[model samples]
Target: MNGTVTELTVPTPEQVARAPKVVLHDHLDGGLRPATILELAREVGHDLPADTAESLARWFAESADSGSLERYLETFDHTVAVMQSAPALTRVAREFVEDLVADGVVYAEVRYAPEQHVEAGLSLDDVVAAVQQGFDEAVAAAETPIVVRQLLTAMRHQARSREIAELAVAWRDRGVAGFDIAGAEAGFPPTRHLDAFEYLQRENSHFTIHAGEAFGLPSIWQALQWCGADRLGHGVRIVDDIEVAEDGTVTLGRLAQYVRDRRVPLELCPASNVQTGAATSIAEHPIGLLTRLRFRVTVNTDNRLMSNTSMTKEMTALVEAFGYTLDDLRWFTINAMKSAFLPFDERLAIIDEVIKPGYAALAAEGV
Candidate 1:
């Protein structure tokens, strides 16, 4: 409300939900529908603390709010338990895409650790193929078209980084978009998987590393300098390198300056950061400053089910906290599209053809 009349008008939740969004850090196993989880759990004879879908959903959201990244991740055990088979994995993946499409996500990269899903005797290749098939089927069935790709993840504390990296490379051309390392970050560091990252680099493949969420600047430093991650998953800790004075003067340490100057995309999930204790709240999130400084800041949903969020919810929260207009929302969307692991032409086409037109129509509506 501080700008011109036209610029002062904030977008409504409905309008924000209609904006085309691009997601880069969503988790495949972390986004299952509550009903699907109950159904799968019953079919597989898995024991869940909550019997009903409503209670189970509430349990996940409450347990993940423990303000500890390790504790928050513990809730995934239930989601992953039912995803061991080809059909469960396929259904979860397809339903995930359908949910994203409904939330106005035009492009998304879903990441999950395939090593965790082979417990039911399914091979790693079978897991990846099933997920790809689900994505393909969902895209075909969506009322509105969406582009969905996969980022195969390796648990950082585990020794299968090299093997998972090889799997990602093998399936890169077949719906697998990139590779990533996810898990607890404090004790298990990215440097431990140097060989895997080196292999990916040698193969000319793209990968992201989870860093700077529960850990500090040192974690981000290692992920970028040591492993050569194409993006930083939840790089919220980069805010540690920035110092702001009471008089509004700002200064950045060497690492933060490098991140901004190089335009390294920060896949910041604001609500998830608060739930995991990386950020205190949305208003105090580093994305506000990073966006003002033109640091290629992008919003994301790290774990939708755990955080009880979607692209619409994330965007609506940001709009309420920062008073972001359609233009500001568009900036974040375009940043995600550009940082996508897809080819330049495909990304450009989505940005120009899909995202821009969607926002333009919303702006014309003046909501």
Candidate 2:
């Protein structure tokens, strides 16, 4: 009750809601529409606590927002349980992009663990193909075209890093843009997947590791020093390594300085952070400080359905909490575009010709 006024002078709600944006850390499994989940559950006879989309959406948000990683992850059990077929996977992937497009995201890279979908007796290749087809169809069908790519993920607790990395490289030209590993952070460090990281690097491929999340700098250090990640998926805990003094002076630890100097992008999901206990709340999060320090911080929705969030919603929360401006939103979008796994020329075109122009048009019209 600070009179709904913010200390940071953030942007208005309308500005954030309408800003053109880019997303790079979304999970396809985590973004299945709640209504879609109900339909698929009906097909497979998967019993759910809520038969309807509204109740299910509430369940997901409540379960995830409980501030426990284990409970947050349990919600995915229901989502993954329903997404066991090719058509189901394809439909979810397509709708994921359609939702992004509707949220003013011009470019996005959606990711999911192929292993999670194979319980339907399909091979990893089949799962990848189905999801890629969905992305293709969605982009083609959009009135405002969305540039979509896939990031194949390996479950961290499992031992399929090398295999999943190969899957990513195998589908490299087939719409798969990069490799990633998700799940537990402490025991399943990227060092466990060094061979995968080495292969991707030697193949001149890219990957993002879900580090510095539930775990801390050790997780991030392994992803960077041991595995050589191009970007960090939810590397929110890096803030733990940085210190700001009473006199407004900043001191960066060795790890933070290294990451900042290398321009390693941080795919920050503010709402999801609060949901998963990465941040206590949006206002106390280090996103504002990181942005001020010029870290390559990119906003994202780690999971739209699970977190009950969208890119616009994430930006809106940041605006309310930190008082970001339209320029700040624009800068976050550009940061995501720059940090994408796309090639330099293609990434540049997306930003220069597509993202900037789109934003400029909005600004020109005073939208």
Candidate 3:
């Protein structure tokens, strides 16, 4: 309440790890295990820069911290290059869910472009089906189990936005929960996909767009007013519209008021934001400011390998930087689950049974 408290008490990793979590913005291609990438690259003769899995993992972490967006995105080329086949997509998706389950995620929505993975002669249907099969396998093998949903993504700089929008609708109720457009948000405005957004609207489909991350308020404005996005993928840049007076009073711009008042979810990724130069550092990040303002803010790992983060790591960073408590962590998880594209009944069941009781256990322990 006092800006960031002078006597900030952060949660321990154990406390954060034990709590149930939810992720709504993780990318399927961005989250492959380092070891699997090494093996897969070798099998496909992709000739990675690093010889060992450990080094390769370190390479991604280091490369992503460059504070340059164009360089940050180039790293995904290698991961996507190897994920052109059904087996590759399936294996990666399975491992993605397995990793989320281990990180105490009770629910996750893993997103990727169907068009990006079809280079191996697979149809759009084949790519989605393969990823879904992998998710089914991993869900079955989870300890307490986690629900996984796919968000079909259309690369914003590409011309296939409308086509991918249709693919997403076709996969609705089967595995894909919604649609998203990711990539270079500055010049490639969400309005560029007006046709796709309109089609998704006609189908009554839910969608989030990559906006207000590397860009600013105009990007967020177009996503909400022009494209009619249901959620924002990394809406961290919406902080551009929040002004704080010297006396500690705060004011929201018209767009910010609409986002907060209308309860449009902002999928905020603090650590990833820093790596991408969206925020200078986690403490200076607007996440605490936004959450304190009662904006529907949630934590996420935009890239597990690149950002070197899990959902637990994201929470730990929040605790260390913002002095977030177990209560704060619970609020973030519920925010993510609530903003998820699942049916109302399914989302409510997860909140009641898994999330509520999980946080309750910590509360009983004097957390």
Best by TM-score: 1
Model 3 residue 333 distance off true place after TM-score fit, in angstroms:
1.1
Better of 1 and 3 by TM-score: 1
Clashes of each: 0, 3, 0
Task: Give per-residue CA lDDT, model 2, range 92-154, as digits (tens).
Answer: 888888888889888899988999988979999999999988999999999986789999999
Ranking by TM-score: 1, 3, 2
Minimal lDDT window, size 10, model 1: 1-10
Clashing pairs for predicted structure model 1, backbone only: none
The most accurate candidate by lDDT is: 1
Comparison by TM-score, 1 against 2, better one: 1
Candidate 2 vs candidate 3, lDDT winner: 3
Name the Cα RMSD for model 3: 2.8
Cα lDDT tens digits, model 3, 151-180, are 999999999999999999998989999999
Query: Candidate 2 — worst ten consecutive residues by lDDT sum?
Result: 1-10
TM-score of each: 0.97, 0.95, 0.96
Rank order (by lDDT, best first): 1, 3, 2
